[model samples]
Target chain A: MEREIRIDPVTRVEGHGKITLHLDKKGDVRDARFHVTELRGFEEFCVGRTVWEMPALTARICGICPVSHILASARAGDAILAVRVPDAAHLLRRLMNLGQLVQSHALSFFYLSAPDLFLGWASDPAKRNVLGLAEARGDLTRKGIRLRAFGQETIERLGGKRIHPAWAVPGGVSRPLGRADRDWIASQVPEALDTIRTTLRLFKETFSTAEECTVLGDFPSLYVGLVTDDGAWEHYGGVLRVVDAKGKPLVDGLDPARYEDVIGEAAEPWSYLKFPFYRPLGYPKGMYRVGPLGRLNVCDRFGTPEADAELEEFRARGSGRSGRVFDYHYARLIEILASLEQMKTVLEDERLLTPRVRAEAGINAEVGVGVHEAPRGTLIHHYWVDPNGVVTAANLIVSTGHNNLAMNRSILEIARRTIKDGAFDEGILNRIEGGIRAFDPCLSCSVHALGRLPLEVEVVGPEGAVVQTLVRD
Target chain B: MDLVIGIGNLLRRDDGIGPRVAEALRVSPSVSACAVCELVPELVLRLRDARRVLFVDADARGTDVRLGRVRDEGSRWGHTLGPEGLLELAARAFGSAPDAWVLSVPGFDFGYGEGLSDRAEGFVPQAVERASRWLSEGQVSADGA
Candidate 1:
């Protein structure tokens, strides 16, 4: 009898999804999948809207990372008009993007990922949440909340409100930063640094265990992210590059608008999430990863003093290389530090407070593409406008879409490694979930829906015989 | 103290009902005396403090309720509060319960099109009136009665 295992509506990230595993007669893993239930049709509905409204409208995709959509859409619209945005406008946009990275990553690392790290992977499922972690270690949870609040405050201070800010507009921002905003951000830097250092220490401690290092060590997959010609990671502005597992850049200057040419989307019958593959390599060979792990593998350096030091440590820790999956989690904290450092740099640039912000341009063309590094990964927004500036076509290749292949690969690897110990074992299931969470996918941004952290797990024997099941109701 | 939260999406047509109602209460003399707020889930903890929470959002609560019709919600408040895991864990951990109600706006087209359908928008005032009455008159009983 072949065994089967399933996890439904995995929680703490975004959107709805289920995972299923199939075992052959030999009790060996034969197949696995991550199925996304929600349908993302933001692109389909964007049609007929004026290009000018893209920034504000696209931000509605996800309540968590709307700033990413706002910036990416505005950049794409700027491309259509063929106008250079003012320096202040660009700086303000970068500040907000950095703020997003800090806040979003904090939410993922402290609130979502820490439960498993702190309480142990096999901790009670019911007590494996923020509140549960609070019960176990109140001080840590409080710090996590305070740290997350700082990130949200950054959004509120600059964008005027945290969740969705309509400040970023085409050609530039609607307004420039005021002194009050700068002072507010500056005042928080010390505490933010404290939180960053504390988090770094905590992460280092949590992940230093030999088991963690070897559990998911250096799994190979193609990496993709935005990089400058100098080979530095450029979150706000740069060309998209795809690199193979061997650390060689495979392609450069990949236009955000021409994503269709470089990548392709394939639908899995079991999942609403589309698997995006490198067009040149085809689906199976084209598997690649985006987000923290992929970004760490692709970028040569972070370009900040403290972040540089941390990156060196990360490179040294990954068995003398910087490309391991362990580095992905560790590097996320470093990137959090990098983002804060970058925020300070961009904020201090006096040009950010200048009066000249929005660079108004009459829409001279109908087609445009915008791409930017969202907190989770790279995001591309492409739109085709009509003569009246109304959208005729919209195609969004979100960051999560890019990681579909990598996620599938990860699920299989985890399932295979843990299947020998009994597929239904709680510890194994939790670890598998932990590995997937390393990707930190924003499914809500991809397919629009919200509410509920539902998780389901099932195990079956050979010939599809049921063995065990667990669900977080 | 009583609380009213508007939970509608401003872009999608009828989904705007909650925000509109919250906005009306914020300004209206009738229900302005009570505590009120507009938020999404990230602020769930901030809301857990409320003695009573009346949530207003667009909902497709089966076919019985007419679009925009304001109906007294039943005891299904547990589902909408937080993610299932958090909600379940909080309920088990705290052993404390709060009074709550959900005001569902009968939604016809929640598609990507602009604003709520005319039918939904036209019924906004009635929804507001009902929500306002609940805020003003409902008691925050121990059982959330």
Candidate 2:
């Protein structure tokens, strides 16, 4: 008898999705499919707008990481104008991006994934959440909340709002940083650093050597991220870098605007997200990973002292190559540390307070491309404008889209290893969801949709009869 | 200060009601009103200093404009935190949470668009009025009575 198990609306992630597991008569899992059910059509609606509005409009795509879109879109607009931004403007933008990374990565690790790590996976579905973790470990919960607030506060200070601040403009930022704002931001840095260090220590004590790390999405794949010309870890603006599974450089310093020459997007009817592949390797074979794991894998070293030390320790974990998806949590913590360090460095520099932030210019080119390493991974915003500076077309290669292929592959691999004889146990289901959580994919950012829907999982027998169902309301 | 946060994405039809209500109430000197795209945990910190907090949002499950007290209903691990989660975090992190309420306006047609449905738009005045009354009188009748 052929049986199918489905976990719909995978819980604790940003978007809506489901997993379907296929089993043969022998009760062995044969195949699996991860489906993204929501769609927003951001690309279609963005057409016909003025190029100046791209930064503000695209920022609304996701409330969690709107700053990422705002910065990337602004950079794209800069390309269209062919104007170099002022140094002070660049530092301001980098500060905003680092704030985003801190908040976003904290949300992913502490709020979303920590419950499963603290409470046993088989804990009551209702009790396996942040509130529950708060009851079990109040100190840790408080640290998570405060740490995230530090990031949000930094964003609110610079962008003027925590969710969507259109502060970044074409060729530069809209306003320069005031002394009061700089002082307040500087004061918050030390505590943020302490919080990240504590969280890293806790994580190392808890799950760094757990069995799940070896089993969940632990496989070799190509890694990609942004890197400075000097081979330092970068997030805001830099050339492309690709590395093989064994930490060998495949490509480096490729111009971001010419991404089409090296990358390809493949469409699948079953999912709304597109599979981005390395053009040289072709479709499934070219499947690579992005985000924290990918970013850490591609960078030579973090440019900061503390983050560099942590990176060295992190590298020692995987014998100089941290390719396991499980390491994403650790990488995210290290990045948080690095972001705080970078934030301090930028704030301490007096040049960031210069009055000349934006460059005045009209559109000098027909097409422009902007790229940034968002909290989730690498994000690209490409726009085509008419002579009057109205947008004719737009293509957004979001960070989540870049990891679509790897996510699907990870889901299948985990399902096959965990499920047997069609039992579909709660522990097994949790492990499968953990694989997806490792990437912390944002379905809301990846797929466009409105409202929060309940996640439902169902099992069907050979005759297509409902066998069992799990629903998270 | 009394804080009122309007929560929802303006791009989604009736979901924009919260932000629209906030925009309408921006001139009120007594209320510290802000329009946010969604409810996140950080909101608790922002609202911690307020004497009272009122969250105005669109409710697809509701049929009429309703005002109710916010309570701690536990927290989910996802990014979107509800009114209950916000209150809980405030209580735990700040030692005491402000009195909180939810002003839910019935909404339909939550598709991708910039404007609100006629039904949701019609309830805006009533929602704003109720919020004003709550601010002045320190109490609101249930179910818009």
Candidate 3:
């Protein structure tokens, strides 16, 4: 009498994933598992390549967040070369990462998750997409489009193009920000600021109830991200920090280069993505969430005045617990506000126009690890090269992979909440998919591929015979 | 706005004909050129204000360049929102869409890496000439003249 339900090709968010829910004969939600069905052995293939090719080659890892890889890989190379990238290049790299933060987050909010927020969860599945959201609120959708474009524009101005710029090199960047470029980039910030403010107000206003957040991946787990030395918020460069569900710091100022000592990757038979856990606690038990929610929990305050204010209010929404995974969407908006304010501060500096951007060097170290925050979460790139600078080993712990344990738990939580007593419908299906989208996962960044999303739910009795089948075409 | 978009993968041999032709086109004050791997939603912004736009890509269907206007259609999408979906998105969001045409250049090779095949290269000048005309004149004819 007990059966299993398979939701294949989970929709929205990024990449390809599926969820299998197991039920007792009484139709009660008994257990669930989330799986990553795609895989690309990215680290394995780059082993013999010259270390110098890493920044450019690894930039191709994920088109959505290549800047993260470019910066991370270049930072790793900088370690191998052992030269301090000039201040101007360092600032420029931060600028590009900020640009990345804006664009990738915009894509997650407007294009991927907006439908679930705007359209009712049970809205006609066909109309629950950006186009549908556009039909209802075209002006807002246009603004969203422009906001995302502004993020890409910032990158285009700095890296020479939005995706995979050849600018960030090992020792430093290949070019400096021109005065004209700075002025142009600076001019665009005010409108972006206005759009985000308008969006924040709308998200808070339109979300009239807190009922949705309570059941939507609202569970206790550890949170991890980068934090400034004094515990201020950070994304580009900072020490690794981990805070428990109660926001108590368990690990502080850990040398990111020594991440292996604390963070361990565990494999699950059903998924290609590794489950990364805190070493001190052990596998699955060491499970923690990352990305916006993690960063928000780990940081004491965003450095900017406006964003700091927003951060305080955002945290207050929890009342007496850790952040709800649902708040990831809210956290992205605050981060955008922070990024815009930060962009203004960076552009105002005269050093942005410096001609001395890069430092020259040869391989000075054998093993190097680059650590920083991708828009999604903390991304680490480790590379080992020979004295001749050819890569001997490479490892990449993508941001989505870090949240593997959290994502599966989120799916399980949503599935248990929605699927009860063996009842199934589209509403239950969407809530589950929406849970994954809340993370704005880039399976391409994690699994390194994108596949089609088709919906077909198959129910099989414990004897492995089909009990009931559902299809969406 | 007059826009010429060379759309295809430069890494896939002859499929890269699109960008090569875009590179050859004299995009100036009257026309702007964009070379992309494929169309995505962001390109909708560029299309919203355009008075005329031409999408150029290599196609295996013909031995010669064939051009046609993209039909106004449904707005479903995938990893790369094709030209039709992007135009549809532009129309939906902005209340109007640029007059858009797709020019598919026939090619013999679409293997890995850059550069067009000799046969694919042979058609570039023609594709470039037609794309230039479309962006400037905003015309569509049965013959693609």
Query: In model 2, where do residues sit more than 4 Å from their true spots?
Result: A447-473, B8-33, B46-51, B57-68, B71-80, B92-96, B103-133, B136-145
Alpha-carbon shift of residue B57 in model 1 (angstroms) = 8.5
* Superior by DockQ: candidate 1 or candidate 2: 2
DockQ for all models: 0.10, 0.33, 0.66
Q: Which of candidates 1 and 2 is the stronger one according to TM-score?
A: 2
Assess every candidate by TM-score: 0.79, 0.88, 0.94
lDDT of 3 by residue, A264-349 (tens): 98775567777889999998899998898899899999899999988887767777335577888988988999999999999998
Best by DockQ: 3
- Sort candidate 1 into its docking category: incorrect
Per-model lDDT: 0.73, 0.84, 0.85
Winner by lDDT: 3
Q: After superposing candidate 1 on the true structure, give the runs of residues whose Cα lies further than 4 Å from its correct spot.
A: A253-261, A320-326, A421-423, A447-473, B1-145
What RMSD does each model have against the real structure?
A: 7.2, 5.2, 4.4
Candidate 1 lDDT over residue span B7-107, tens digit each: 65566566666677667774443233221223322344443455655666776653322223223332122213332333333333344334556666676
Q: Which ten residues in a row have the lowest lDDT in candidate 2 chain B?
A: B71-80
